[model samples]
Target: MTCSYASRARFHRSMTRPFFSKDRISHFDIFEKHAEDALNQVKGRLKEGYPVDFQDMVCRFTLDSATEFLFGKCVGSLSAGLVYPKDSLPGQNREYANHPSNLFARALSEAQSRSMLRSSMGTNWRLAEFWSDRIQKDMEVCHRFIDPILKDALERKRSTKEGEQSTGHAYAEGKGFLEDTLLGHLVNCTEGKADEIVNMLIAGRDSTASTLTFLVYMLSQYSRVLKRLRAEVLSTVGNSRRPTYDDVREMKYMRAVINETLRLYTPVPFNVRTSTEAALWPGVNGGPPIYIPPNTQVPYSVFLMHRRKDLWGPDADIFDPDRFIDERLKYLTSNPFIFLPFNAGPRICLGQQFAYNEASFFLVRLLQTFSSITLAEDIQTRSPECDKGAGRDAQEKVIVKHHLTLYVDEGLWVRMGEASNSDDV
Candidate 1:
């Protein structure tokens, strides 16, 4: 349902209350289960010495995790199995490539890409699709996958309400009815429950997947950083032991690695917002203030901002997690606005902390399981030259682009060396 900005903000805040609760956030076991499953899938694919599309595997991982968290049942994307580099012997597995969950993921991704294109087109978006609705089919595919789950949730909610009324054990009015999952809570109060759940799936799945993809990509490029990060992971969580919430929190360098990845390859690189009222923005240097009228669409790029030399220092173009931990972190401390991978203010991502936790949990398990990572550049589908830029950008080994979120163009193809017992801390 359509809502005014103020009302929508309130609704979003209320909807996300579950995530803000400490009790809810303490569910690390659920996150770890999905991470372990995804890691095992990666290992399975690499067992034959074939490179796996790590990006695709992580996307499945996040999708399964997000669906389970929001809908109480995972879509089982990981069970579809990991995809191999194109044209390879293993890549010919038509069954794996055409799995139902994989189809749903592709449809969702296509829908997101189309939505982004429409947003970029502004008023002319409709005209481009005047002859036919390009997004309809893909959205139908998505709905087909989600509607049954949503219907089941609604039925469960109805049953619960009837039970409460018959037993005269209705929850107190002020405390609100407690629901076990976000889907239960949403189905209890929202008319557009399906839409809300889908929106959240996009936020939860793609953002974390992108971060993990780039984090791995970055690590593959920098052996020293990978070694140091693995060292920290082993020192803190150890091998074979599942990482707890507190264990993840204690891995400071690992957190820096994640933050650095977010800084360099922000998932939602570009975002737009409409001004609710007239405002004035300070100009650069000593220039006069610039006026902004009400309803003006303001587009911002955290991606570009994150790479600015003046803001992040001369080595801004470089990938160094140390900047986040060393004295150079003072720049970000003094100018907080300079770093905003998750945006800022009232509309900041409600899933920000969840994304951090998910990425960290997965990375910890990954380091524990793998001793080394190398890019399968020989089979990489997208050419690095596709991303045209100077300096460090020009030297990038893989193509990166965005749909609703940043992603490596084809996929982040990599071969991982399994951690031997001797490699363990």
Candidate 2:
């Protein structure tokens, strides 16, 4: 019973399973079952105008949500409006002081934005180097924070060993992804083992944060899209009950909105790959066969590709979910080679299913709960007044900073009101 509780309680999947499959576990499923628990904990605080950083809230919630599904223990980031302690895995926090997760999140955000701008300018390679150094420093903060948790997981796994089989939960139940991957790798591979665990923590924290931040911003910016999403949520789950994973999966419009948002503002704006060997496009008797030697580094800029006019049409800039309404998905072929939000081909995101399901669940819930959302006054009022530069196009004004992931310079801020606002108005 304790084993079951422990397995179901945390975010990291046990080490016995394949390392890659760890993230495939879905926290949205847990969120659905514990919806009332989360709401009862948070609703009162939200009602009091406690000035919760909604963006941070989403990140923390995703963190806890993902962790619980992977491990069996749920850290109370969302419930207490704080980060899970790096030490005892606090079932709850005694006070609301800023936590490691918050500091880590903020540091990652600043580091990424500064780095992106420096790289984009391309004038000084030295600036890029400096940013890289800062990122490394911030990473130390992350390592110090996650190492203890990983150690705790290892100790727990040790405790559960031997003839506890049959009745015993899998290692994933107790130790989670950290133990599973570390233990497996120790048995198999050599070198840089600790680095992989660090990568997971950094990757998990920022990717979920950036994606949800962009999603919320889009939902706030486009009212019609927001309404359609909310309507779908209401029709499928109704107002009183929480949505199951199946219900979230089946919500077509909500999925479409998410797809569109991802298309426009992917979490990873760019990815780079060096050509392993020479490659070619047939029937192009132009220059040489585009000889990409073995050592050549090729970068794929997802941001530019997603925004290509030839692919998405003139209104590629627009946030229209109807682009995905067709049954055959033909409309999506504006540019056959375009749209690699999660990347395409063999190396696609393994956690894509988990991300979509989680995002869909959260988005639907947010829409169901909130009626009106508008840009905060300062961002809305000052955006037009800011002189981007002498010749900078308004289209180019979309700031893309590379924090842990690409985050807007300022966190996406918006005003949200109860879903009944329309009725009252």
Candidate 3:
């Protein structure tokens, strides 16, 4: 356990170093290229008058960008193209569904679901898989796709001797370009452990994709919010040009919308941690302290916490971005723990800023290209019938599915209205 913790800390440090530093502006270019590629595909669907699955497009965008950041070459999931809505005029293309990159994504998602089940079942999870290991089967598919890339990276590493010069373009003065890929950095930090790389891939791909998916879903529901957000995007960055990091930072309303979406639909909604030692919890309203024994498993739900009426006021259940920017923000400012979308403390998400940048960049380009978004409820596969009682979940238009990270059930099928030349600022 100590070794595991130390290894993780070392890996985290490596990631934080030059890769995510403020000066590493090249990453935004990569994000912009992927976002443009994704939006271009969506435009194709729009011209064809076919509804696109926004969730799937964002997933491919993140996957391509994450792979490029990690391996110096993307899996090119975008090349497989945006999938047509189920039973739509184009129908589900067999070749597109069976693309190697798509297969890897499907396998990775399955592996995550199995891992979540194993964690939920604790020590007895193996008992259920005694006859057949489902996760292993899924992982085999993933490995089949990734192993060739790993082999190539390993070969490249072996060719470079000690103190050897790199052939790639240098990003800064005196800093060589070999460390550009996270995989190469991990090779030096953690000896290229496949599992650690996979964990990073999951972190890079799903979390941001989930956030974008929900953000679009929310914008579709509230036209006023969408109009305001698009205005911010157009006014700040214009319609034709790419947005700089500074430009993204300047858009306060856009940030508020992103924050509100994360507050309501955090990608990793539930988390569990084991106590290292006995601890006492402060009671609410001067009540007695609660006892927590050492090594006890503690599971918490940020989803429920972010929605509590007492914490967020009576309109907590409503999808309002104003809570993040208006007077109601005091509730979180006073007690910041009430808003932990990417979590808090030492073990908080290392890629939190990266996720924000990628999401922000993509959203800017998305709103710039598309003037309006309307849900294709007729083609949406998931129904809210399973939700019981009252409140947000009960009245949800799109069903939320939990598989390690939150995702729209079936997919967020939407018809986006393309912006004309006059729509540009």
Candidate whose TM-score is highest: 1
Instruction: Tell me the whole-model lDDT of each prediction, alpha carbons only.
Output: 0.84, 0.57, 0.83
If both were scored by lDDT, which would come out higher, candidate 1 or candidate 2? 1
Q: Which candidate do you rate higher for TM-score, 1 or 2?
A: 1
Q: Once all C-alphas are superposed, what RMSD does model 3 give against the true structure?
A: 3.3
- What digit string (tens of lDDT, one per residue) describes model 2 on residues 294-346? 64546667876776666676767666778777642464664445767777654
- Report lDDT (Cα) of residue 69, candidate 1: 84
Q: Encode model 3's per-residue lDDT on 1-425: one tens digit a residue.
A: 13566577666665545566665542487898898899988998878878889999999999999998877779899998888876765565677778888888899999999999998999899899899998998899988867886776665555554224565543341223246777766554544544567878898999999999999998888989999999999888788788888888899998899999998999999998777678999997999999999777788999889999999999898899989888999999999999998888766777788888889999999988988998888887655563678788776788888978999988999988889869733
Give the poorly placed runs of model 3, Cα more than 4 Å off.
Answer: 1-18, 162-177, 192-194, 282-289, 385-390
> Residue 172 in model 3: shift from native, Å?
13
TM-score of each: 0.93, 0.71, 0.91
Clashes of 3: 0
Q: Which rank order by lDDT, best down to worst?
A: 1, 3, 2
What global local distance difference test value does model 3 have?
Answer: 0.83
Could you tell me which 10 consecutive residues in candidate 3 have the lowest summed lDDT? 169-178
Off by over 4 Å in 1: 1-3, 169-178, 191-194, 283-289, 382-390
Residue pairs of candidate 3 with colliding backbone atoms: none
